[model samples]
Target: MAREGARPAYDPAGHDTALRATLQELRTGRWMSMRRLLTETTAWWQWTRRTQVLATAAAGTDVVRTWLEEEPHSVPATVMHARVCVERALRAHREGHPHTLDLWHEAWRASHTATRAAPPDPVPWVCLMALARLDRERQWAEHRVAPPGPMLPPGPWGLLAEADKRDPYNREAHHRMLQFLYEHGTSGRLAEAAGYAHWAADTAPPGSALHLLPLYVRVERYRRSGGRDAALDLHWVAEDATREAQRALYAWFEQTFTAERSLLDLNHVAHALWGALQFTDATRLFEALGPYWTPQPWAYRTPDQGDTAQAVEIFLQARARCRPA
Candidate 1:
């Protein structure tokens, strides 16, 4: 961990200096750094994460498009082309852009192209799963497919399965499905999403990150509840809340490497531990987080949403309370 009492800064890249540097390069319309980084990224988890992050930057510019124009046959460029298209489509949908459908179709084509270009990679299939969120009407039969079990609503299970075939229990794949569930189910207190999260957590291995999925659902519930709650304190210390926090800490955080941990996952687990009054346990997560904090689960705790300064205040207070001996 960084020096004690150091203030944490929000970084989307979060501990991946290579990704931070690549983000800068992409901002300047350079793709070689991205190319080299992807070329060296052999792990599936890292590959998908890096591609997803890079695409967020690439979608706002012609970086990926220019890279593709220069190297039509490059598989990395091809995959990134799909990533950018998917990113653009998601953004367009979120912003209610005029050409959302066109971008979605374009992204669909790109995702398929990337799947063929990199057959064993799960990211392309994950792209398809993410797009399922756009199909609110379930125009595609696959999007309305039956769930694998009870209490789980119908969704693009096949697309998720395709990702699972390549990378079983892939983190982003499940999260994409979770996003679809949030949109598919209800406006307040997503019971189905919580069910799916618990289901995923129950089936995952002890060391898998899926153990933390339910925590995200809990945060979402709090977020959608207008960000202010008189019973919020009790909500965090509820028996179920404490159980999920301990489950994730033992099953995922303790078994996983610091490098394998996501910043948001770390923040959530720590926040959960703190909320549940497990200060000593929370301290370990805070230590692992070091100087990089993701303003999430913390921001939702306050009435004001999206205020970084307020989020940091709550985060620091929690950190101070749980300071390790």
Candidate 2:
């Protein structure tokens, strides 16, 4: 059964299809394929990480744990196990399920094990950062921490530093660190997050995915403040704060635009532009995306609404506005 004007749960685009096949390979114990898929290229690790997270969220933690048990020293499997644990913890928190702290600790232990197994792999360290964020949130909620400081202890920053040592340009590592700092930084200010985003963008090499950092911060800001209408506030758009965000977004789009690699970023950029009333620019992204919609930026826009419905509505609206007949 299908709802009217609703997008499917998962759009079968080329990348999505590839990810599904890769997950199948992993589930089938195709270690060689998994290694080649994860390690043979740059930025491919992001897809691996994303795939594991999605698979774990959709399936369950036991599948990934079984994969880990099958390959004790497998870096990919271990990292994925850690990621699955972290995702489960986050999901439990969102759903108000019990034993979230226990899940967080499990994620921490798994990430630590993965880090030990593959000292040079940044993926495990990225998982540590995620665990650290969860732990920090737990501490804040429990202790009611005072202002001017995060409840984070020393370990997470060390993990991020090690990740940087392993891969100075690790996009996921940087993004995770940015999220950690943005939420827990002493000032708790969007300006601080923007500062980190701009610095990362400036330091990154040309055509680097780090250019989307500011857009990430902007999306976070929008989510924290409110949904679509709040994001579309004239004052927020006209303020000096968004000037750099817009510049960074357009720069990323101009320099490193691709429908293939970072479709998630494309979705974010489209959402940002649409909120800013840049219908034409948003339309280009919608065209590039075609029917393959990532339910993130749209989902965030309307938290109470179904993700597929929200995504479909936004996509159709952008298409109509951008391609008026």
TM-score on alpha carbons, each prediction: 0.96, 0.76
Off by over 4 Å in 1: 186-188
Report the lDDT tens digits of candidate 1 across residue range 1-325. 7576788987778889898999998899999999999999998888988998899878889989998999999999999999999999999999999999999999999999999999999999999998999988788998989999988888999999999999888999999999999988864579889999999999999788899999999889888886666777688999999999999999999898877788989999999999999999999999899889988989987778788889988999999998853
- TM-score top scorer: 1
Q: How many collisions between residues are there in candidate 2? A: 0
Q: All predictions: root-mean-square deviation over Cα?
A: 1.4, 5.5
Candidate 2 stretches with Cα past 4 Å from truth are: 1-16, 24-36, 39-61, 137-155, 186-189, 228-232, 235-250, 257-260, 300-308
lDDT of 2 by residue, 230-323 (tens): 5355643555435544654566666664533466777777666666666676666666565566777666667554566776676656556655
Q: Considering only N, C-alpha and C atoms within 3 Å, which residue pairs clash in candidate 2?
A: none
> Residue 324 error for model 1, in Å?
5.9
Q: lDDT, candidate 1, residue 308?
A: 80
lDDT of 2: 0.62
